[model samples]
Target chain A: MTLETNRQLEDLVAKAKSGNKAAYSEIVRMMMRPVIALTHRMVRDREAAIDLAQDTFVTAWEKLSSFRGDSKFETWLFTIATNKSINYLNSAARRTTERLDDVTVSRVSNSNPEDDMLQGELRSGVMEFMKGLPGQQRAVFNLRFYHQMTFEEISNALGKALGTVKTHYREAVKKLREHALAKGWTP
Target chain B: MNCRECQDELLLYGGVEALPEELSNHLDSCEACRRYLDEISEIAARFRADSDLVSESVDVERFVEGVEARIGRSRVDRLPAVTWVRHVAYAASILLVAGIMSVGLRYVDRDSPVNGVPPSTDQDYYAEEELDEGVVDIVISDFSSRGFLEAGDELLNDVTEDELKYLEENFDVRNLLL
Candidate 1:
């Protein structure tokens, strides 16, 4: 982040702490992209991701006064976002009557079983691979990889220890790698 | 060390902290394991890159509106700010109304026979006014109501020293304050 932007963020944080609605709104606007993107990857459902992201922001806003600038605002926001998504996933798992046995993990293959699939098909294929991951692993992978959050940031956000965060991240990577290799991915 | 141990420690290779020196030295010497670690790192990177493929941008406007509304409601609920403010405002209004009512009562009393009705002595003031529970309802509404809250708020906030002194001397205004 640029120095100017950082200063602006500090100003926003100050305003938000003082209950300035517009400052809070601007902060939310800036964070919307990463929040949505991370939620989408974690939940694997766009509509659900949006809902979870909204929930995350609402939770953040209500809890904004408690924020102490100990962590970056985005990191704090992501922590809340990831937790909300995880909780939603947990609740949905309980309410869902769908059979896990019937749920097939999707595969992404470039070699044509069919002649010419579009880029969208290829993207969907990758998504299917992601959707197959266990929930927490998916979350760790999404935040670390896609959101580019450091393990320390993840740990602080998730209220986890450094070892635990690293474990989740490593396990997530190892699983994805093993899964990819098993399906004959070269690089 | 065997491949299993190597892989386990390798998992920590990327972010392992406070490692035993012996294991760290072994990792340095083992070319095969080093190659494996490099491959793992590359695989992790690829997977990280692929995560972006699964995500799409979202509608900021719609999302912000929903988020703002929910946040506003939650703030109100959590802080009790809305309720408290309403209580304060209603109390103030009620006090204002009472002040107005007292003024009207005084004006009417100026032409009446009984100068000493003693402020109706809490004798179902509604029934005496022939009000069908409506006036009573207005005065007795929850602390959140505009009429009661504003009136009470004003009484609490704007009460004169003399009025408070009077209540202190003659009434349990302390208990009423709570």
Candidate 2:
């Protein structure tokens, strides 16, 4: 978020607005990781997350002319990505086909292999715990805890009232902790 | 404040935000609340850690390529449909112009003869002669008055001026002369 980086991004956005595909591709390259990460966390499916990320960029490109520069480009992009992910999750086809048990959590612990397995178990357990919550609550939790976004920003992105977003985060935390305890996690 | 109230505030903010002085004081004196705070902190830490791990594991190149491929395919898919519409429009325009030209040509052909024959030719003069000999005589007299009789005087030399006046009176030859 340096001034120089902001300038560079603005330049890219300007170029993209003028129909420069290369500039847009660079913007995509710069944003693809976080976009995919946010989308992956939301959808919990890699392929679907990739598809959503691609779709988010495609939509952003198609609507580039309508961008009024009222907000940061990243914020605008996140709004589109969040809505797209939420809509996909809410779709009947996705609802019927998406399975919580399909996720295979990988362990990244470097202490010991036994500890790694336990950490992997805990990670997977947390993911499964999160899957039981509603999509909006889970999104709020992801944005708040994982992405470290303020509730106010999440409210703007999700188009929900700030109080409602805070309540969702609180409820999500309560459910997640309860699920973790129910799964024999201490604390 | 009571433990329940402190814990409720902690649940909302906890490790995510700095606790107020009152909540911080409560946690220092209460083991249960301290443990509760620790548990929330641990959960948040674990989630953050897992998120970091997941982010680190993502294949940036693969994701970029996937996005590029999807965009390319979408553009490619739309191009043919757009080109087809354009082609259809062009063909319709060409047909429209050709139809207009054909109609105009038919109108022109109907207005004029097709064999290069002038409408006011010698055959038309002969047809008029068959219609009325006296009318022909007046036509010849009118032509002679216009100085066109030098080549055809032998044919109308017998017709007199009085005969021309009678033809003009009976046949309204003045309309033709005009």
Candidate 3:
């Protein structure tokens, strides 16, 4: 979808490629929020989200030569983000990375600590439930529900078949619905 | 299209791309499909809201600068050609220093040459001088053993008492013969 001006984006990309500081900075400014948002949803940790976003841009810069303007720059950017996010998730899973304990500890320190506690509990419950999902399903759910990516966009970004992406998303939604319902969320 | 097909394509519709006027008009006209479309749109809006629920504003300037700095540092790190030149210059410097040291050492303390390069101390000079004296003595001994035996006898007898005593103390002819 033509969300933004393609000619403007093309100009920005060209200027960035030429080592123009202002152009590069502008590109980062525009892409950072969406990237951070996507990573935050994918990993479900703000700090980790920031790290993942930074890593994503670093990787993109290094591999910028491979970006052949075949798709929208944002699409291409998100595609890089998707691969990086998935790889991060897989690597963290393989290494058995633990959830943030500080979030639990700090739950009692907020001004309205009860609200914080409830939110924290809900967040932890959802995260734990999400952890049980298969990798591709989890990714699809995060992209679809959290990043607001369409099935076709997600399919393109992940380099997966459209059917496969849709299937994973459907399965993810089904699993999440089951989990939420079991946890006493009103249907 | 059937409701199922329309449901499947609803997400693409939500993205608000250039849709055919006929499909748009159909969604507007059909109550059942419109209800389905509204539900899908509601779900999408909820997701959009969730995506927008960012707690903090990202430091875009800092982040961009940080990434740019990182890229710059990495580029600097890849100065292989410069590194090679520096390394060669370093090696040349060391070799030059060693060559200067060797030349200075020879000039400061003359002695018998080593590989055509002179020794580097007074002690070495004296040691080499002694070595030359020993060689001369050996050559004389070899001559005496063959047919130059009378030369040593005449030289020993021809010397004065003080001179002979000095020669004996320094060379020790009796010890040498043994």
Candidate 4:
């Protein structure tokens, strides 16, 4: 982000900390999509992702006082979202009981009926392949490709070594490639 | 670069990262490596395209409204139950401690030997009997021991000797002995 955008976010954070609900609401608006996307990719459940995203914001609002502004607000937000997603993924009950289905995909997609159906199939396929990845590797892949995060940034967010983050990203890509090849999806 | 080195660099190349000149040159000369790179690129592209599509298709307004509703409900639901339980537990603990202390203080004050005087030491009080052989025998059993005798004697100190003898004759010694 640019310096100006950073300043704007810090100003909003300051306002929200001072009990400005509007500012907090605006922060939620700004962060909701990425948070939901991150969670959806990790949990592979739309309703759970939406719930987790909302919970992330709620928790952030509750603990906003501890946010020292040491890192970017987006980084702090992403860390919370990531941890929540990983937690949901790690929960055995949720993993075993909550299978991805077409209904969930259709409900989450806002496209036209036909497009929604096709996109839902494609998304489920992608999610199925992604499920083969370990949670951390999948997280790395999603954060890098979907959110366009730098490896260094991901390392800081995950509290892992830079080399480790790179390895995860590489392994994620290699696994996806292998899956794609196995299914004859290569272009 | 060899095929292994080329394969290792495929992901980095597919991600468009700057690579060593040797790897770049190998990719330029190698069709197999190029095909592998294309496959990785295709997979990455597919992921990116799907991500973008999903991003555009999410309902932002619905999500924001849901979050607002949850936050409102949480604010209302969270505080009362926790505060009530905490206060109830605190009050119960205080009441329990007060009741114990009150009963303990009453027992100690009522059982003390002399009025406004602390109970006597163990060696200062004893129940003794003189046999026909003129031997003094001290009863050291717990119920007849020094502290029990002090408390019992303090309770009976004002009684007449005849009354004390009558009470002792009427009281069942077996229960106290057990």
- Among the numbered candidates, top DockQ falls to 4
Residue-wise lDDT of candidate 4 within A41-146, one digit each (tens)?
Answer: 8777767777888899988887887899877788788888888888888888877785754454554454587877656666766878777888888888877777
lDDT of 3: 0.64
Question: What tens digits encode model 1's per-residue C-alpha lDDT throughout A41-115?
Answer: 666665677788888888887888889998778778888888887887788563373222111123233476562
Question: Which is the winner by lDDT between candidate 2 and candidate 4?
Answer: 2
Among these predictions, the greatest lDDT belongs to 2
Task: Provide the interface RMSD of candidate 4 in angstroms, 1 decimal place.
Answer: 3.8
Could you tell me how far off, in angstroms, the CA of residue B71 lies in candidate 2 after the best superposition?
4.2
* Winner on DockQ (1 vs 4): 4
CAPRI band of model 4? acceptable
- Which ten contiguous residues of candidate 4 chain B have the minimum total lDDT? B128-137
lDDT of prediction 1: 0.66
Model 2 steric clash pairs: none
Q: Per-residue lDDT tens digits of candidate 1, residues B9-104?
A: 776544323345656677788887767777777655555444332223345676678877887677534576777888999999999999999999
Error of 2 at B4 (Å): 2.8
True contacts kept of each: 0.46, 0.42, 0.25, 0.45
DockQ of each: 0.21, 0.22, 0.13, 0.24
Top-down DockQ ranking: 4, 2, 1, 3
Error of 3 at A169 (Å): 2.6
Tens digits of per-residue lDDT for model 3 on B98-163? Answer: 999999997665644656866667675675555545545654666467544465655555555665
Model 3 segments beyond 4 Å from truth?
A: A1-6, A92-95, A98-133, A144-153, A173-187, B1-37, B52-55, B75-178
What TM-score does candidate 1 reach?
A: 0.58
